[model samples]
Target: MNRLTVRAAIHVAAIFAIYLSVAMLIPAAVDLFYDNDDWQAFAFSAVLMGGLALAVALATQGRPPPVSTRFGFLLVNMLWMTLAVAGAVPFMISSLDLSLTDAVFESVSGITTTGSTVISGLDQAPPGILMWRSLLSFMGGLGVIALGLFLLPFLNIGGVSYFKIESSDIEDRPFERFQIFTLSLIGIYSTLVFTCALCYAMAGMNGFDAVNHAMSTVATGGFSTHDSSFGYYADNMAILWTGIVFMLIGGLPFSIMILFVLRGHVDALRDPQIRVYGGYCLVFSLVIAIYLTVANGTPFLQAVTHSAFNLISIITTSGFASDDYSLWGPFAVVCFFVATFLGGCSGSTTGGIKAYRFLILFELLANGLRRLIYPNTVTPVRYGDRTIGDDMQRAVILFIAAFLVLWAITAMLLGATGLDFITALSGALTSLTNVGPGLGPIIGPAGNFSSLPNAAKWICTAAMLLGRLEILAVLVIFTPAFWVR
Candidate 1:
C-alpha cells in the first residue's frame, strides 16, 4: 500500500509488459506470412505497448527497497491485469472487431488457461490471432508455474507453506540459485512443447496446427486451432494419444519433474501427490470407459482411448473435447463434472481443488473416524513422509470451503443473468476450476461462451482470475485487515 511497494509493482509490470510486447511480433510475422490483414493489429499493439512499457520501465528503474507481503499480492494482481489489458488490445484493434468485454473475457480465459472461448469459427480466423492465443497459454502456463514455485508459497495460501518448508530444508533445495531453477524450468517446458509438436506433426497434423496444439497440450491450456477441439482429429488415434500423454505430463508437479528428469532422482516420481493424481486419473478413466462401453455400446478399444483422453483433459483442466460427451447421457455428464474439481498435482499447470488437497481431506476424515473408535490413539497425518501441521491442515480446509462458497455465489450470479440451472452451475464450476466449457446446449463442449451476456462474461473473468490465483491470494487483498498495518 505504500509508495515504494506501488512503485516496485509498477516496475515489474512494466518490464513484463515489455517482454509481452516483443512476444506480439511472433504472431505478427505469422499473420504476414499468411497474408492476413490482422498483422497490422499485432504490429500496432506491439509498438504501442512496447513504447509505453519502455518509458514506464525506464522511469521506475532503480534498486527498490525491501517490500512486504502486501507487495507480492499487489504486484501479482496488477501484473495479471496489465497482461489481460495488453492481450486484449489486439483483439479490439483487429478485424475481429470484438467489444471490450468479450476481448477481456477471451484474454482472461486464455491467460488463465481456462480455455473458454467467446470467439468461434476459429478454422477461418486469422493465423496471428490463433498463434497469439496459443502464445498466451504457453506464457500463462509458465507464469503460473513460477508463481506456484515462489509467490504462492511465500504468501502461504492453501497448504502451500508445506511446499516451501519442504523445498527450503537444508538437504532438499533443488538449486541454490533462483536463476538456475528458472533456467531448468524453461528448458524443461520448452523441450516438452517441442517434443509434443513433433509428435503431433508426425501424427498427421499440419505444422501450424501441430505447433499450436502442442503449446496448448503441454500447457494444458486447450486452445485448439479448430472449434471442434481435438475432435477435428477424432479419427487420428495417434494425435489423440499424443495429447493424452502430454496433458498428463503437463499436470504433474514440475519440481518433481525437474528432479526426475534433470537430476536423475528416480524417487521423485514416487511423490504421494503424483501417486494420488495418477490414481484419480486411472480410476476415473476406467469408470467412464466402462460406462461408455456398456451404456453407449462404444467399442472397448475406442472406449478406452476416448475415455482416457477426454477424462485426462478435464482432470488436467485442459478443456479439450474429442467428442460431445454431454450427449453421452446424464451419467457421463455427472462424471465429467466431478472430474472438473479433481485438478492435477500442485505446482502443475492445471487448476482446481488439486489432487493433494483431496488426499489430505480424505486422510483427515479417516483419522477423525478412527478417533471415535479409539479415543486415546494419536495419528499424525502425513503427505509423503512429512507430518502435516495443524496450520497446514486448517489452510487446506479453509481453501476448500472458500472455493465451494465462491462457486455457489458465482453460479447464482450467472443464473441472475438469465442462464438456466445447468448452464449457470457448470459455468461457475468451469470458470472456478479453470476447466473450460460448461454443460448444456449453451456453453457445453459443442458450444461456446459467445452467447453469454456481457455481465456474465465479466463475472466469469473474475472467477477465472480468482481460481487461477488459488482464490485466497486475490481475496486476501480486499480484506480491511490486510491494509491496516
Candidate 2:
C-alpha cells in the first residue's frame, strides 16, 4: 500500500475512534441515571480518547485517498485494534478496577463480538460497563457485515469472491452506490435490533435488559446482562423463543435479508448457503434434543426448546446458554464442541469455519472421490446453480487447514500457561471461532474467563482478533511478499 493509503486508513480509524468515544457517553449517561460513579470513568475516557482521535483525524485530513485491495486488510486490522483500545479505556478506569490485561480482553471480546468476558458479578455490575459491552458488540456486528460483504469479496478472502460476483450480477441492485447501500444496511440492521428489543420487552424483560440483549442477539454476540446468561430467563419461554427466532435470523446471510426486505427478492432466501445453514441448525438441534429427551429424561417439548436454543446458539456462535450442556454426558459435550466450529453464514456476524466453506469442502471431497473412482471423471463441483472454481476450492481448503493449525498452536500456548486440557483446547476453539464459553469447568457455559492466567487471556485476545479477521487477512500481512512494492 502507498503512503497515502496508509494515511487514509489511519484517518478512517481515527474518525471511528471519535464515534466510539461519543458512544461511550450513552453508557456514561446510563451510569449517571443509576447514580453510579462509573459515569466519571466513561467521561474521562470519552474526553481523552475523543481528543486524541480528533487530533489524529485532523492531522491526516485531506482529499479522499485511493483505496487499494491491500489497504482493505490494513484498514480493517487497524480499525479493530484502535477501537478495541478505545473501548478498553472505560473498563480500565471504571469502578470495577480491572487490570489493563483484563480490560483489553473484555474490550477485544466485545469488539470482535466474541462475547468472552473476564469480569464476574455481571448481575450487579454497573450499567455503564454492561451498556458499553453491548454497544461494542452492536458496532462490531455492523462493521463485520460491511467487511464481509464489501471487503472480503473484493479481497477474495476464503472464497468470498463468489458473493461479490453474485451481488454485482444482480440487475436490480438494492442501491446504486456504496454510500446508499451502507445506509440500507444500517437501516435494516437497526430495524432488526429494534424489533428484537420490542419483542424482549413484551416478553417481560425490563427496557434496559431488553435493549442490551436485543443488540447482543441481533449481533449474534451473546453478551448477557447477567452471569447466568439466558439461564436467568430459563423459565421464560417467551424470551427463549424470541431469542431462538432472532438468533436464527442473525445466523443467516444479511445480504439475503436485505434483498428480501428491500427489493422483495424472496428467491434470494433460497441461496444454497442459507439452506445448508438451516439444515445444520435443524439436524444439530434435533440430535441434541433427542439426547436430552431419552438419556437425560427431560420432557420432550422442554428438551426441544432448550436443545434448539443452546445448539443454535453454539452453531451460530451466539454463545447464549439456557442450560449447561457440558454436564449432559460425553455425547452431548462432543456435540456442543463440534457445533462451536460450525459458524453461521459467511456474510453474517457469527464466526468460525462458516457454513459456506463447509459446503465447499464437502463438494471438494466428493469430487476428489469421484475422480479416484472414474480416473478421468468430468464432474465440476457445483454450489447452487454456479460451478465452483479451482481458486475457491483451494482457498476453502487452505483456510480450514490454517484454522485448525492455529487452533492447535493457540491451545498449546494456553496449556503452557498452566490451563488444563479441556480448558486449553476449548478455550482455543472458542477464541478462534469467536464463540464464548469453552467446554471445561473454568470457561464453560456456567463460568467466565476471570480465573485464566494473564498470558492465557492475551493469547485468547490475539486468537479473537485472528478469528474475527478470518485468519488469513492478518497472517498475510506477516509475509515478506506483502511488504514488497
Candidate 3:
C-alpha cells in the first residue's frame, strides 16, 4: 500500500488517540481536586486508549493512506465505531455499573454529540464521569467540524463548495497550508469554548460544571451536568440567551469567522449561510414562542425561555431543554422535529440536512415559477447570486431522498427490536440525523435512553454512526464493487 493508504486508518486513529490522551488527563486533575475515586476510572481509560493509539501509530508509522471515495466512506464509518468503542471504555470502567451495550451506546451518543444517556442518576454520578461525558461530546463536536473541513467537502454535500476556503481539513491541500488552516480553526474553536465557559460560569453554574457544559453547549452537544438539563435553572432567564448565542457561534462557518477575526472584515459575518441560518432561528423561534404564549396559554417568560433555548438547540441540532417539550402539544413536537432536518450551516458542528440546501431549493422553486409565468424572463436561480446548476439541484434532491429512505429503513429495523411506534420512529430519525434528543416521553429532550433494550441499543448505535458519516459516505462501502479490491 502507498504510505497515505497505509496511514489512512491511523489518521483517524491518531486523532482518536490524541483526543483520548488529552481527555484522560482531565479527570486526573478533577480527581486530585475533588478527592473522587473516579480518578481510577480516568487512569485506566486513558492508559487503554493511549496504548491502543500507540499500537496503531507505530504499525502505520510514516505511512498514510491516500483516501479515495470508497475508502473515505469506510474510514468515516470505522472512525466513529472505533471512537464509540474507545470512548465507552471510561464509562464502562467507572463504578456506574453500565453494561457493555449501554456504555457503548452512551459513548456513541457522546462522540456523535447525540447526548442520549443511559445513566439515570446523573445528579449522583461522579464528577469525573460527567466531565468525561461532556468531554466526549466536546471532542465529538470537533470530530464533525474536522470531518467537514476535511471530508464532507470532498463528498460535495449540500453546497460546501462555496467555502473553497482551505485548511488542514481538506485532504488534497498541501501540508503546510492544511496545518495553517487547521491550527487557525482550532484556535477559533478553542476561543469559543473558553469564552462560553467563562460566560456560563458567570451565568450561574459552578466553575467546573460551567466549563463542562460550556464545551458541550458551544459544540451544540447538550451534555449537561444535571439530569434536569437546562430546566434545572428555570429561574435563570439570561442564561438561556447566553446558550443561544454560543449555539449560533457553534453553528457558524469557521472560515468566515477567521476572516472576520483577522482583518475585522465585518461583512464576513454576512456570509450567505450565516444570514440564512440565523434568519431561520429568528423567524421560527418567534413563531413558536408566539404560539406557545397566545395559542397554548404558556406564560410569556417561560414561553420565550423554552422556545428560544429549544429553538437554538434543535435548529443547531443541540439537544438541550429548558422545559419538557413533550408537554408543549403536537405543533411544538412537529416543529422541533422539522428543525432537526434543517440543521445549522454546512461548516457547523450541528448535524442534519442543513439550511443552505433548503435555501437553494426554495430559490430554485421560485425561479421555476417565474420562468413559467413569463417565458421570456431569464431568471437565474441563485444562492447569493451564484446560479444554481442542474447537477447541484439533482444532488440536493437525491440527498434528501436518500436521507429519508435511510431514516425509514433504520426506523423499521429499530421497530423490529420491539420498541413502541413513537420511540422507534423518533429514535430512528434522531439517530439518523445525529440530533441528540427525540420525541415522546422516554427519549424526549427531558428523558434518557437507559431504559432501552440491548437490541435497541445496537440499533441506535448503528443509527448514530450512520448520521455522523452521513448516509452516502458509509452506504457506498456496502456495494459489491467497494470491496472488490
Candidate 4:
C-alpha cells in the first residue's frame, strides 16, 4: 500500500477510536451514579484512548485521500482490533480482575455480538460495566450493518455486490446518498431499540435491565444481566414473549425495515430472504416445541413459548435461552447445533451463513439435479427476481467452503489445547458463527467461558474477528498477493 493509503486508513481508524472513546463516558456516568469505584477506570481509559486517537489523527492529517479497497480491508480489521483493546481497559483495571487475555476475550465477544462471556456473577456486577458491555454490542451491531450494506458491496466481498444500490440521476451524488441512507438507518435502529426497551419495562423489568437488554436484543448481542439469561425471568411470560418479538426484529434486514418505515408499505414482507428466514424459524420452533411437549412432558403452552424464544434466539444468533434446551433431548441438541449455522437475514446484526446464501445454495442444488435428469439443458439459478450470475454463485460457494474449513481448523486447535471433543467443536463453531453458547458441559448454555485456557481465549478472539468480517476480508489481508499491490 502507498503512504497515502496507509495515512488515510490510520486517519479514519483514529476517528473511529475517538468516537468510541466518547462512549466510555456513558459508563463512567453510570458508575458515578451507582457510587462504584469503576468510574475512575472508565474515565482514565477514555482519556488514554482519546489521546492516542487524537495523536494519530493529528500526525496523519493532510490532504485527505479516498481509501483504496486494499486499505479498506486493513482499516476495517485494524479498527475493530484497536477498539476491542480500548474497550477492554475497564475490564482489566476494574475489580473484575480479569487477566489481559480474558479481558480481550470478553471485549471481542461483546464487540462481535457473539454473546459469549468469560465472567460470572453478572447479577452482582457493577451497572457501569454491564452497561458498557451492552453498549459495545450496540455499537458493534451498527458497524456490522454499515459494513455489510456499504463497504462490503463496494469491496465486492462475499457476493454482496448484488446488494449495491443503484442511483438515479436525481440521486447521482454518492456521498450524499450514503449520508442520507446512513442517517435513516440509524434512526430506524434507534427507534427499534427504544420501542423494545419500553416493551421490556412494561413487561416487568427495572429501567436499567430494560434498557440494557433492549440494546442487546436490538443488536442481537444477547448479553443478559443474569447468569441464567432469560431464564432469570422464567415465570415472566410477557418478558419472554417480548424478547422473542424484538430478537426477530433484530435479525430482519435493516434495509428492508428502513424501506418499510419510509414508504409505509408491506414490500419488506415480500422479500425472498425474509420469507425463508421466517419459515426456517417457524418450522424449527414447532419441531422443538413438539418434542418438548410430547417427549419431555413439558406443558404445551410453556413448551411452545420456550421453544420459540430459544429457537429464534439461536437462529438469529442472539444466544439467549429461557431454559436449558440442551437438556430437552439429544434431538433438540442436534437441532440447536444445526440452527447455529443457519443465521438470520443478510444486512442484519446476526451472524453465521446468512439466509440469502442458503437460499442461493438450495437453488443451485435444485438446478444441478434438473440438469442431470435432462442433458444439454441450461438451468439458471434465481434469487427472487434476479438471475444469479456465475461470479455471484462462485463467491457464495467459496464463502461457505471457507467458513467450514476455518471452523474445522479452529476446532482442532481448541482440542489441541485440551478441551474435550464436544466443547472444542461447538466452541469453535459458536465463535466462528458469533453464536454465544456451545454444547457440552464447559461452554454450554449453563456454563460460561471463564475456565478456558489463555491460548484458547486468544484463538476464540481471533475467530470472532474472522467471523464478524465474513472471513475473507481478514484472510485476504494475510495473503501474499494482497500485499504485493
Candidate 5:
C-alpha cells in the first residue's frame, strides 16, 4: 500500500471519529434533562474527541487515493481500536470516576457489542451514562453490519464472500448499486430499532427504558439500564417476549432482512444459515426448558419462558438475562456454555463462530464421510444453492481453528492471572464470542466484570477486538507476509 492509501485511511477514520463524537450529545441532553452534572463530562469528551479527529483529518487531508485491500484491513481494525478509546473518555471523566482500565474495558465492551460491563450500580447511575452504553452498542451494531455486508465480503474474510451480490457491469453501475444496498441496510436497521422500541413501550417500559432497551435489543448488545438487566422486567411477560422477538430479529442475516424488505419475499429467510440458527435456538431452548421443568420441578411455563429467553440471549449473543440460568442445574450450565460458541447468523451483529461456519463445517464432515464410503465417486459440498469452493472451505476451517486456538490461549492467560478454571474458561469464551456473561459468580449472568484485575480486563478487551474482527482480519496484519506486501 502507498503512503497516500494509509493517509486516506487515517483521514476516513478521523471522519468516523468525528461522527462518533456526535453521539455524545445524546447523553449530554440526557444529563441536562436529569439535571445531572455529568453533562460536562460528555461535553468535554465530545470536544476533545472531535478536535482530535479534526486535527487528524486536516493533517491527512489531500487528494484522495485508492485504499488498497491491506489498507482496508488496517483501517478497519484501527478505526475500531481508536473509536473504542475515544468512547472511553466519558466513562473516565464522568462522576462514576471509573479507573482508566475500567473505563477502557466498559468502552470496548460496548463498542464491540460484547455487553460486558464494569459498572455495578446501573439502577442509580446517571441516565447519561446508561444512554451512552446503549448508544455505543447500537452504533457498534451498525458498524458490524456494514463491515459484514461490504468489507468482509470484499476481503474474503472467513468465507463471507458467499453472500456477495453479483453485479452486471454492462448493465448496472457498481457505485450506485453499493449505495443503494447500503441505504437499504440502514433503512431496514432503523425500522427494526423503531419498531422494537415501540413494542417495548407497549410492553410497559417507559419512554427512556423502551428506547434504551430497543437499541440494545436490535443491536443484540444487551446493555440494560438496570444492573439486574432484563431480570428487572421479569414480571412483565410482554417485555421479555418483546426482547426475545427483537433479539432474534437482530441475530438473523441483515442481507436477508434487506431482501425481505425490498423483494417482499421469504426466500432469504430460508437461507441455510438462518434455518440452522433458528433450529439451533429452538432445539436448545426446548432442551433447557425441559431440563428446568423435569429436573428442577420449576413451573413449566416459567421454566420455558426463562429457558427460552436466556438461551436465545446467549445463542444470539444478545446477553440479556431474564434470570440466571446457571442456578438451573449443571445441565443448563453446560448448555449455556456451549451456546456461547454458537452465535447468530453471519451478516448479523451477533458474534462467535457464526452459524454459517458451523453449517460449512458440518457439510465438510458429511462430504468427507461420503468420500470415504465411495472412493470412486466425487462429491461437491453445497451451501444453499452454491457449491462451496475448496478455498472458501479452507478459509472457514482456518477461521474455526484460529478461533479455538485463540480461545484456549486467552483462557490460559486469564488462568495464569489467578482466575479460577471456570472463571477463566467462561471469561475467555464470553470475550471471544462477544457474549456478555460468563458462568461463574464473578462474571456470570448475575454478576458483572467489575472485580477482574486490570490485566484481565485488558486481555478481555483484546479478545473482544480480535473476535469482532473475525481473527484473520486482525492477525493477518501481524504476519511477515502481510507487511512484505
Candidate 6:
C-alpha cells in the first residue's frame, strides 16, 4: 500500500468515527430519558469507532502522497467493511441481547441499504434504535449516489466506465458540473423524502414514523418502524400511491435527473431508463393484478393496487409490501421469483442485477441472432444513443455471473446450516442484494432475521458485504496479485 491509499482509508475512517459519534448522542440522550437498552449499545459503538478511527489516522499519518491503484481499491472496500463492523457495535451492546453475528448482519444490511433487519418488534423497540435504522438508510442512499458519480467513476468499478464515456475528454467532466449534478441529486432525493414524509404524516403516521418510512421508501429499502411493513396502513391508498411514486423517483438515475434541474426542464418522461423502468412496473403490476383477481379471488381494485405496490417494491428491490405475496396463489409466487432480477436503473439506490444490464444482454442476444441470419453482417449493442462496446457488455455479464455465484454459494452454505430450501435461497439472495425480507417461514416478508441461527446470520453478513461492494471490490482484494508491490 502506498501513502496516499493509507491517507484515504484513514480519512474515510475518521469521517465514519465522526458520524458514529453524532449518531450515538441521540441514543445516549434517549437512554437518559427513556432508560432504553439501545442507549448502551450506541454508547459502546461510539467508543469502539472513535478509538479505532484515531488509531488508523495516527498510524497512517506519515504515509505517502499517492498509493497504487490496487491498494486504493482495496482500501476503499476494506474501509466500508470495517465501518460496518463498527456500526454493529450499538446493536450488540443493546438490551436486545443480540449476538455479534446478528449485530454485524443488521449493520451490513443497513449500511448497504439492503433493509434486511435481524431485529423484531419495532413497535416496542426504543425510538433511538429505530431512528438509527432510518439514519442508516438515509446515509446509505446518499452514499450510493456519491459513490456512483464520484468514487465508482474514479475506481472504474461496476461498469462505472459509462460515467467516463459521459464525461468530457478534457479531464472528463468538469468539477463544476459534477458539483451541480451532485447537489441536484441530493435535492431530488431529499425532496422525495420530504414529500413522502408529509403524505405519511397526513395519512395518520406520527412525524418520526413518517420521516423514517419516507427515507427507507425512497431508498428502496424496506426498513419499517412497524413489524407489519407497509401493511400497517393498508387502508390508506393515498400513502401507498405516494410510496409508489417516490419509490419510482428513487430508482431513477440522478445524472439524468440533474438535466431538468440544471436546464430548467421536466423531461423525466423522455429518459429511456425511466420509460423502461416504468414499463416494467406497469407490465408486472398488470399481470400480477390479473392473476390475483382471477386465481386468488381478490377484488379487482385491491388486486391492482396490491400488485402494483408489491411489484414496484420488489422489482426495484425495495422489499416493502402491503401484503405478503407468498400467501397469494401460485401465480404470485412465480411473478415475484422472476421479478427478483429486474433491478432499478443504474445510478439509483435500488440493488439487484439492474435494468440496464438486462437491456444490454437482450440487445446483445438480438444482435447475435441478426448476425446469424446474415452471415457477413456486423451488429453492435447500444444503450440509449451511445453504442456499447464489448468491454462494457463483458463487464455487465461478469457482474451478473459473479453476483449469482455468490448468491448460490451463500444459499447452499446457509442450507447446510439447517435452513430449508426456500428460506436459505431467498435469504441468501435478499441479504446479498441488501433487499429486506426473504421467503419462507423464518425470514420471509412477514418474518424478520432476528430468529436466524448464528451461523446463518454470519453467512448473511458476508453476502451483504459482497453484494454492496458490487462483488468485485471484495473479491479483487483477496487475489494474491492485488497484494503485490
Q: What is the TM-score of each candidate against the true structure?
A: 0.98, 0.98, 0.91, 0.97, 0.97, 0.92
lDDT of residue 367 for candidate 2: 85
- Predicted candidate 1 versus true structure: per-residue lDDT over 238-314, tens digit per residue: 99999999999999988778877878888777778888889989998999899999998999889989999999999
Error of 3 at 308 (Å): 0.7
Task: Give the backbone clash total of model 6.
Answer: 3
lDDT of all predictions, in order shown? 0.89, 0.90, 0.78, 0.88, 0.88, 0.76
Worst 10 residues of 1 by lDDT: 162-171
**What is candidate 6's lDDT per residue for 23-133, written digit by digit as tens?**
777767766677665676677777777777777766666644454457557666866776677777777777776678887887778778888888878888887778777
Residue 92 accuracy (lDDT) in model 4: 91
- lDDT by residue (tens digit), candidate 5, 1-485: 47777788789889999998998999999999999999999999999999999999999999987646787788888889888999999999999999999999999999989999999989999999999999999999999888887787777778466566311211243335677878888899889999999999998999999999999999999899999999999988888889989989998888777766686656656788888889999999889888888898988788778888999999989899999778888888999999999998878999988888988899999988988999888889888786888778888988999999999999999998899999999999999999999998999999999999889999999999998888889998888887673
Task: List all candidate RMSDs to the true structure.
Answer: 1.4, 1.3, 3.1, 2.0, 2.0, 2.5
Per residue, candidate 4 scores C-alpha lDDT tens digits across 366-476 of 998988998799978888876878877887898999999999999999999999999999999999999899998889989989999999989999999999998989999
Please write out the lDDT profile of model 3 over residues 397-417, one tens digit for every residue: 767788889888878887898
lDDT, model 4: 0.88
Error of 6 at 63 (Å): 6.0
Tens-digit per-residue lDDT, 127-234, candidate 2: 999999999999999987887887877776774565754443234565778787778889999999999999999999999999999999999888999999999999
TM-score of 2: 0.98
The pairs that clash in candidate 5 are none
